[model samples]
Target: MTAYLTVVEAAEHLNTSVRFVRRLVAERRIAFHKVGAHVRIAVVDLDAFVQAGRVEAITDDRVRRDLSGAA
Candidate 1:
């Protein structure tokens, strides 16, 4: 049996807000199961989502310059 977590629990586990978790579900960025009106997220799926969406630290001078409007 796969362990599932409620949106609130998942958000807490991820150290994020419940709203953010809901947005992820609404945006289809994270995989989830709906049991009635409740959203359940599998632990594995959550980990996978985090791994897939992990962003590297931004240290590119060119990119920073463009972002800072310092062309």
Candidate 2:
């Protein structure tokens, strides 16, 4: 079953402040739902949001090649 979380719960899960989570909702940066005057976020949506910001690590060979070109 999909889990729905409150703002505070989302913040805790993200290890961020409640205000930050609220800002995301305010800016519509993250998907959310309104249920009878309450805001809720889905675990899947939150996971997607986190994944969207993921940056792949560069290998040492690529870094060396770029640095070599600077010489």
Candidate 3:
């Protein structure tokens, strides 16, 4: 069976604040479920959310070799 987490748990797992999670729910940005007036977020959904927001930084490191403040 898949695991489901509460708003608090979701926030903790994401290392963010509950307000942020609540805001996402309010903004309809995150997948969630309603169970008897309680909110639940699937673990997969949380993982997906994180993966979706992942960013890869690409930088060229061959143009910087300044070890002194003399230009």
Candidate with maximal lDDT: 2
Cα-based lDDT at residue 8, candidate 2: 100
Q: Which digits, one per residue and each the tens of the lDDT, describe model 1 over residues 1-71?
A: 99999999999989999999999999999999989988899999999988998887777987888899995
Instruction: Judging by lDDT, tell me the better candidate of 2 and 3.
Output: 2
User: What lDDT score is found at residue 42 in candidate 3?
Assistant: 96
Badly placed stretches (over 4 Å) of model 2 are 64-71
State each model's CA lDDT, in order: 0.93, 0.97, 0.90
On TM-score, the candidate that comes out on top is 2
TM-score of every candidate: 0.73, 0.84, 0.80
The weakest ten consecutive residues by lDDT in model 2 span 62-71
Q: In model 3, which residue pairs have backbone atoms overlapping below 3 Å?
A: none
lDDT (Cα, tens digit) per residue for candidate 3, span 1-71? 99999999999999999999999999989999999999999999999999999986644442342344334
Candidate number with the higher TM-score (2 or 3): 2
